[model samples]
Structure formats: structure tokens, C-alpha cells
Target: MKEIWNLAISPQVLPLTLLLVPVALYWLLNLLGTLDLDFLDVDIDADGPDGGDSSGGHWFHGALRFVNATDVPLMFVLTVLVILLWACTMIGNVWFDASQSGLTGGLIMGVSLVASVVMTRYVVAPLKPFFRMLRADDEKHPPVVGRTGLVRTAWVDERTGQVEIEMQGAPLLLNAKVATGTLSLPKNTEVIVIAHDADTGIYIVRSISDSIPPQSL
Candidate 1:
């Protein structure tokens, strides 16, 4: 046990230890509810082109094509490769010469550092916009049966139309339709959301009484 502890703290294992500290800290902070790292984005393909090509060359193009075909994130692939390389170094250290093991470990550490930086900068940063968009959509579309809105556009008998409804401190553009057997509501007509149609993913609406104001009526 002492030997293992000493080895864990040794210079040879320093890089791995450093890399693990942040992961451990993130988990600890999450458990305490003091910090949430779930939203912290990390990407492994940051150095690639805007379109995700590694370089404007055949080799990069081919590599990206293969990565895309596998339907896996580039960071995940890089992570597995780093793990395998490190494992090889460990095994080589145990079964082969000491000098060879140290060299292999150093090489693996260098590669892992570079990959980590590139991914953090490129892949993770670019995904923030997409995450924000998803969050916005979720907030805009809540499952409420009794809400009110005005038809923002005309609805045809067989077509979808948009409505503007306010909910949760914001106005959302949503798909809406007139109640079954009712006539199409014109734009700017006040409507009550009667029910949500799951099949068509729209809300059924009816003309509200003229006495009610659009906002609070």
C-alpha cells in the first residue's frame, strides 16, 4: 500500500494525477450543490476546421469522414485512444524495460495534454449556442392546457399557423389551430388554448370573448 501510494505521487504519475484533480473536484462540488459543472462544455475537436475537417487536405478529410461515419464524437474517440496508449505504456513498463516504459508514458502524457486543450477550445465552445437554443425551446413550449394567445398568422383548413403566447416571463411563438368544427381564426384574433394536440404537436384554440382584454382578458 505504501509503495502504491508513493508511486501515485511520483513524478511519473504526476500528469495523470493532475488531470484527475479537476474531475474529482467537479464531482465533489456537484454533490455539495455548491457548483454545477454539468453545463460546462468540453469539446475534443476544437482545432478542426469550422466544418470539422482537421485540415484542408486529403488526410484530414478522410479522417473526418471516418469519424462522422462512426456516429461518435471526435473527443470520445480521442479519449479512448489516449486511454489505450496509456494502458500500453503501463503494460510495457511492467513487462518490458523501465526506460521504454518511461518514454512511452511521457509520449502518452504529451499527446493527452494537446488533445485536451484543443478539444476544450474548439468543440466545447461551439456547442454552447446549440445548448442555449434547446433551452429556449423548452422554456417557450410548456405543457399547459389553458393559456391564451392571439393568432399571429392566418390558419388554413389544412395548414399550421403560428400564435404568440406569453408564459414564464416571455412571449413564445407556438403552433396553434382553431378548435375542431370551428372556423379559421384570423390574425390578431384573441384565442384561448383549449387543449394540446399531441399528434400534430399543436394547441387547439378558440376565439375568446370580446369583453376580455388580450393581455389579461
Candidate 2:
């Protein structure tokens, strides 16, 4: 245990180990509800031509092709890579202790880093299904038209607004706009979606609740 501890804290392994600390902290914070994974869900492929096309001769983009193919959230991939690197570095330090002594240890450490990357590439393929399942609840599913939602922004009008609707799997956040000529909806105002403009991708809403009328007694 002591030997492993020494190897983990050594200069070669310490750098990788240090990089993992913040990743651990982020996961802890996420579990505690202090962080949201929405930012990590951005589709990097969309920003580039042909949806992250690497065949265009950019080495950096080419190297990262596996990351986009993983389909898991970017942050999750980063976290896994950091962890794998730290573990692999520790293992290499132990196995090649004699060869990894003094200045030569740096070379062995580099090999461990490369090994970690290779392992991550192979590992992410099988993990796609698992990650999809893990993020299933958080994924942005199609908005249900005619469903009632509560305005979350200060005011919802023709130009700007946000709403929160209770979904079967999770709360769905959506950009909304009051139907033309309607008064702006204040925060927490219950509104029903009247129409969805697929081209514009915005929900047209009204403040009137969808309550059923009482039957005549």
C-alpha cells in the first residue's frame, strides 16, 4: 500500500492525479444538486462543417473524432479520461519502477498516458448505450403541445420567455412566447401551450388554464 501510495504521489503520476481532483469535485457537486449537466450537452459536432468533419485536414479535429462519436456528454468523457489516465499512470509507475527511475520515469509516464488514451477510445464504444441510458432522463425530448407550463422568466412575451413543464421523465425547460396580442406572463404564471411553430421552434402560449368546466348539477 505504501509503495503504491508513493508511486501515485510521485512527480510522474502526481500530474495526472491532480487533474482528476477537480473532476471528482464536479461529480460530487453534481450529485449534491449544486451543478447542472446542461452545458455539457452542447453538440460540438454542430459547430463545425459536416457535423465535426475531421477529414478536412485539421489534425486536432481529426484526433478528437472519437470524442464526438462517443455520444456521451463531453464532461462525462473528460471525467472518465482523467480517471483512466491517473490509474494507468499509477500502474505504469509500479510496474516499471526500476526503468521508470530518475529522468527515465518521464518517458514511461508518457507511455502510460498514451495507453490511457488508447484504452479510452476502445472503452467509449461499449459505453455509448450506458451513457444514453444514464442521460435518458436529462435529454431534451420533444415538447408536448397543449400541455400547461409555468412561466419561469420575469416576463413572457413575443420576444422572450421561458417555461417549465412537468414531464413524465423530468422537468422540461422551454422557450415560450405569448400568443399575439396577449398580455405578458409573469414568472410562475400557469399557461397552456396553444401552438408550436416547428420552423421557429417556439411554443405559443396563453395564460388561460386548461381546467375542465364544472358539470351542471
How big is the RMSD of model 1?
A: 14.6
On residues 145-193, what C-alpha lDDT tens digit does candidate 2 reach at each position? 8788888655576754667888887877775788787776666789888
User: Residue 190 deviation, candidate 1, in Å?
Assistant: 30
Query: For residue 108, what is the lDDT in candidate 2?
Result: 71
- Count of clashes, each model: 5, 0
Reference-based lDDT, residue 76, model 1: 41
* lDDT of model 2, residue 190: 90
User: Which sections of candidate 2 miss by over 4 Å?
Assistant: 43-57, 67-70, 133-217
lDDT tens digits, residue span 162-207, model 1:
5777778777666566656777666677777777765445577777
